[model samples]
Target chain A: MADAALRRTPLHDLHAGLGARMGGFAGYDLPLSYPAGVMAEHLHTRAAAGLFDVSHMGQVILRGERAAEALEALVPVDVLGLAEGRQRYALFTNEAGGIEDDLMVANRGDHLLLVVNAARKEADLELLRAGLPESVTVEPLDRALLALQGPGSEAALAALAPGVAGMRFMDVATVTLEGTEAWVSRSGYTGEDGFEISISEKAAVRVAEALLAQEGVAPAGLGARDSLRLEAGLCLHGHDIDAATTPAEAGLGWAIQKVRRTGGDRAGGFPGANRILRELAEGSERRRVGIRPEGRAPMREGVELYDSADALAPVGRITSGGFGPSVGAPVAMGLVPAALSEPGTRLHAELRGRRLPVTVAALPFIPSNFKR
Target chain B: MKYTEEHEWLRPEGDLVVVGITSHASTQLGDVVYVELPEVGTVVTQGDEIVVIESVKAASDITAPLDGEIVEINEAIADEPGKVNEDPTGDGWFFKIRPTDMSQLDAFMDEDAYEAMTG
Candidate 1:
């Protein structure tokens, strides 16, 4: 379908004016890249900074007394203990111990802020409404989210809102940006030191233009964002973690805080907690591990993985695969048996009619540069 | 010189025909990272997929313009596939084929017709 027939963000005009090649993501018509192209945009975000329009992602406010306590019933994370003005990674799990969706929840002073994936917004909204008590209110915010990411991002953002620099990673603050009120969070998906600014649609272009005027802040697209997150070992919602894969299977047990574990005071209250706790203690049978291609051949998703070179018995399948520009190598991720997930273990990815050499490398083929 | 409907470009070089993806196709694929070049001495039929080009976003197939025997393959693309994006028509040529029937070239579009089709 044409980009025009799809939903567009407030920054569409700016992206079009910058000569970006457009594509469909979720239900929005987003920029795939500007004139700089994907490789340059990826490298640029790693070295400098890249501006991304992530407004399509869902943002909601959970208000009322006992908001955190109400939320803890649906997720395994220690939501009740989350400090004000701080963020935490969470997943909405099903009763069967599978992940419904992965999301970010922040403890605002008066209310809790939740950022869920774009594709699961409607379902997640209904899930929350169906589960939460009458005292709790779920309010979806119509705010535009813009992410300025890289080593140079803080400096560029601090120029507009000086107090933002004072907040550490996962910190949130509502401050004035270009004479307009905007909520700023010191977090991003790229694993880089960056900030996600939530502002009104009317002020999105103005704030983006002001940030772009700074040195080395190029506008990026969803293509670069996907490659960036993959290199960082972060899971994409439907691709890496789905309704069929549990947090333990996806290697996301760390998101379950210690206070919410078996021995803690409030243990095993969230949905699928019993199974998740069991898996946490014993480990899941299948594990998600990184695959480093030995050759230049880029083995893509759905390719069957084999135990040995020239072997026919299929062992696993690739979930996400591509050339990681920052790593300067082809990187992929797939589920394999527990015994085959160790780093440096040799494996094979069947392509065409032959089995190509692949090694089980550690997750995050590239190191994360999040500001500590 | 001619262009196939699938955007494969062919240029007659003496008795051999050199093939590459059109500049339009390369730009659409974004950054080309890996390419599977056709093996030399392989016999391919007209319009068969013989080469695989992978970009960061997707993978695309480059089909043969005519029935031919692959003579020479470009090994440079294996080490650095960005050449496909840097120069789609020049250094990024996929392979050279010795055509089994020269009349197959007449089925492709000329420069003007291909330009109109792409635009």
Candidate 2:
């Protein structure tokens, strides 16, 4: 999309002032990297704290007495059971057992706050509006989201909102920062211990500046966020999990709480429950697996995977692949037959007309360090 | 030293020509992680992609600047691709080539012209 047509986040001027290399993403002109470059930004996030402008993501508020129960109709997650101030990962599944979009559902006492993917936010809003009862109001907020991630993120954020230091992973609370009310969540896309702060568009720039000014905190961009999530084995919404992928096939059955499973208290009321439940009971034919390319060359998305060096047809294809700056090697994720999904299973990726050896490794090349 | 539209710099060293990307190109391709260089003695024609570079952002190719045989390759870059970003025009040279027609270098841009084009 043209830069003129692309949307700008509240922190767009702040990013430009920081010398960010802006690029178009999900209809927004956002920073792909700063002057420090993607590699340095990624490494800095892993070692210290990196602030990210994720305001491109959609934020919506679901209000009503039965908000949680109403939401359970769309996602397989047990939203009704989610406690106040806690958040759970959820997905919007279609009737065909395919994923519509993955989102985070946070219970904010009287209502539920839904954070959806940027590309699917509009459609997700329509889905929620049409699917839920009219009594439940769906409000899309014009807010800017910032992710403060890494080992030192707590210290950096605690400096501004001292209450943030006491929260654990997946906890959400309201905190005052820079004289404005900020919705803070002790969660993030990166596997580091961090927080995702939701601020009003008016206060976004000041809040971002305050966070960036903190010691051990640097401004990272979309490029570093992607690499960090890949190393953490977190799936990118469109790339790793998409409209054609089922939760079971994507290895996301864990997100579907047992309460929504076949024999649980809630049973299956969500869309695509039949197929999703079947896949959960009887294993999926294809499973998402981690792939480690043999050499330095990165096996990017769409690279076909084969069973052997001389295989005629591809057994699978890489969904997401890139260099893991933290791991110091190339890592990837792909979907293959269940028989070939085990760690240590050998696979070959066709890169530039050559089939190179790759190994089926465990997910999350780097273990997550979330504060429990 | 001479430069190509693709941002490569070619400096004649005796009969062989040293080829590497300019700092402008390296800065554009931030933090190169891997480089795939052709083996020594490999023959290539002009515009043939002879080197594959993988940066943190994306993958790109360095095409052969002139019809020639690669006399020597830079293994240091293959092992440590960050050199391409650290010193793109000097120690980061990709290969030494014995050009079939050394006059082909005449068509490239000099420092001032290349700077003007990039600028």
What TM-score do all the candidates reach, one by one? 0.98, 0.99
State each candidate's chain A TM-score. Answer: 0.98, 0.99
* DockQ score of each predicted structure, in the order shown: 0.81, 0.89
lDDT by residue (A310-343, candidate 2, tens digit) is 9999999999988999999999999999999999
TM-score of chain A taken by itself, candidate 1: 0.98
What 10-residue stretch in candidate 2 chain A is worst by lDDT? Answer: A1-10
Give the whole-model CA lDDT for all candidates, comma-separated: 0.90, 0.94
> Chain B TM-score of all predictions, in order?
0.97, 0.98
| Consecutive 10-residue window with the lowest summed lDDT within model 1 chain A | A1-10
Model 2 / residue A271 / CA error / Å? 1.1
Q: What lDDT is obtained when candidate 2 is compared to the true structure? A: 0.94
Give candidate 2 misplaced runs (Cα > 4 Å). none
